[model samples]
Target: MQSLVIPLLPELPGLVHASASGTVWAITATLLASAVATPVAGRLGDMYGKRRMLLASLGLLVVGSAVAGLSTTLIPLVVGRTLQGLSAGVIPLGISIMRDELPPERLGSATATMSSSLGVGGAVGLPTAALIADHASWHLLFWISAGLGVLATALVLRLVPESQARTGGRVDLVGAAGLSTVLVCLLLAISQGADWGWASGRTLGLSVVGVAVLVAWGRWELRARQPLVDLRTSARRQVLVTNLASVMFGVATMPVRLVQPQVLQLPTATGYGLGKSLLVTGLVLTPTGLVMMAVSPLSARISAARGPKTTLMAGAVVIAAGYGLGVGLMSAIWQLMMVTTVIGAGIGLAYGAMPALIMAAVPISETGAANSLNSLMRTVGAAIASAVGGAVLAGITITVAGATVPGQNGLRVAMVIGGAAALLALAITTFVPRRRPPASADA
Candidate 1:
């Protein structure tokens, strides 16, 4: 959505860099709150009530959307986004609720179906937002988001059943604090690296501090009765390798986010860019997500047939091929859409496999925490992509307004890097076993 209206940032009144920085800040706040909220909600659901938290979260999202739509300043917009970030937690909590309430055969599919909402949200958010922003007003985007949130809340309250998965573990506040610090530090480093230079003191200090905090948090979780994340159980070969592969896939395949905006945003002078409006760009990308949604069920089928490891490897290979094909196919906008669809298919396949791999490794009780960490890896990978991709873009200027002209050299570099990273992921995933051996908790 931000990408759609990115060129209009300079046009928003009294908002500093509304399209780029303001929107980035909005999503940054959303994702940061989500990083914490998802795990917290999952754990809380296991304790008090999942439905209670889920409904309450939906309320928060409504408030967030209204607040964002009404906001006149950047900071408040970010705060509003922070409130809406609870969407991240809702699905996880829903999964936990279903596991406790539903029968065994239905649990996995239900969890997967609910989790696919992420893709749905992304697919819907962008183009819808662009259309509203272009024709109706940018505020309408949040209004729609809030309205949908309200509807979902009502439906959940009315139809979705609650769970009684009671547990006695207390909130590990200190551990959560440590991990949040680590996330903040690492994310900040990635966000600021291109702008501040990788060698800068703030980057170096924060990176070191992040690592130190994570180390301390690991030790603490090992000893704590109520751990935020149990590293020991998470380190088993199946879980560990799955998590590692997720991080790689996350980092490797995110070039779409980087590529889509540049491809659409580039001026007409560039031979590559179609120079279509933001809405057109979003429309093109939207189908990729739709394709992802459709492929998710197929992905589940693949996981069932080929095993999660094979599905993962196949996803990686396909992703690499998608990127490779993209290199030769970027001459036109439709070609961009086709390549993205391929990439999205790969994502759907891998995402479907991730949970299966996780379940195969850990005790049922620890699934939420393990998956939360897996989610964290993805967020970290995306942050890195954002930083690196931004740097690549910033390095080469097309000079449309200046005397000296340049081509779309920077964007091409970034896209090729995306392909190369996918290749790297394919290589790594190949070593993952098919129907890998079960892992002991301590292993």
Candidate 2:
């Protein structure tokens, strides 16, 4: 639902503009809320019970979707979307639960499937939302989301068991507050900096304050008995580098999302544009999600055979190849589909490997928090990708039918940048320790 709003914007600019701050908050609300919710929910899941928290998260999703579905105005939409954002913790929590409940040998494949669901949901949601938007009232989107959330909640309640892992201690309230503040400040600055002007006082001030708060937050975490994030475990070579690579992979994949839809939907009179409708555009990208789901088990097999580190590097290469293909292949729908599915394949392999890599390095007790932090790193990378892609597209624009749109050259530049990020991730993955360190409580 968060991502569905973006592609829907070009189709419903008027309806979005009718909202509180226009469509800006439509995307920002979810991004900011998710950034705040993921780590905090992870901590809560760690301290209490994972299944209980998972249920709570899905409940938020159901309520959020219902709220958005009923609203005709922007404020209500933003509020509902914020509620949906709170559910972002589900994936990481699910991964941690698998780590705890599944057999050691089964952990890799199970967690891989869980991790791939993140991409799968977004991939399927985009086109599915587009189809509904094209065929019915836009409000129906939320109603459908709510229904699915209800179904997911019921299935999880029936099929999944709560993990026995526990880190019994007081929830570090101060750390949670500090981390939330830092993330909100940093993401706000990044997401809005382009609009506010990158060098503007508001952007720079928030950036500085976020950094200052982060320093203090780190100090607080170091001293706390049960920190929201276990910095020591996070600092280990394998854990640290995997997190870094995850960020880069996030950065690389996000632009494909932002750029491709625009290229596909732009008017053909623009010479380079494919001139497809929003529904058609979504259909083109649908295969990418299907491929990710299909490739996830294969990704697990590769990780099992060669270790997750190899799987990650191979994913990075494939992602870079996809972006490289986009630099030339984006002119035709078939070419775009091929490019997106290939990128999806790479993301499937890389996302599947990340949890395995983190789990190997961190103690079982710390799995929820550790996985949450890794998830947060990817969120950070995605935030940066949105900011960078926005700036590039906004800077280079052409007037089509008296309205400004991003130039074809700008789209190519974005693809190239994405490829570079994939290569950077590949380089970082190389630094991850080849051997897993023994997991201990102290780590």
What would the per-residue lDDT of candidate 1 be over residues 284-332, giving only the tens digit for each residue?
7876667767777777677766777777777787777787777677778
- Candidate 2, 1-443: lDDT as tens digits: 56667556655557645743476787899998898899988888988988889999999999999998888778898899999999999999999999888888888888988898888788888878878777888888889889999999999999999888888788899999999999999999999998889999999999999999999999999998889998988998899999999899989988898899899888987888888877787788877778877888988999888889999999999999999999999878889999999999999999999999998898888888889999999999999999999899998999998989999999999999999999999999999887665487554
User: What is the number of backbone collisions in each predicted candidate, taken in the order shown?
Assistant: 1, 0
- Residue 393 lDDT, candidate 2, scale 0-100: 95
In terms of TM-score, the best-performing candidate is 2
List the candidates' TM-scores in order.
Answer: 0.90, 0.96
C-alpha lDDT of residue 65 in model 2? 93
Report the lDDT of model 1 for residue 429: 64
Query: Model 1, which residues run further than 4 Å from truth?
Result: 1-10, 13-23, 101-104, 403-407, 430-433, 436-443
- Model 2 CA deviation exceeding 4 Å by range: 10-21, 437-443
lDDT of model 2 at position 225: 84
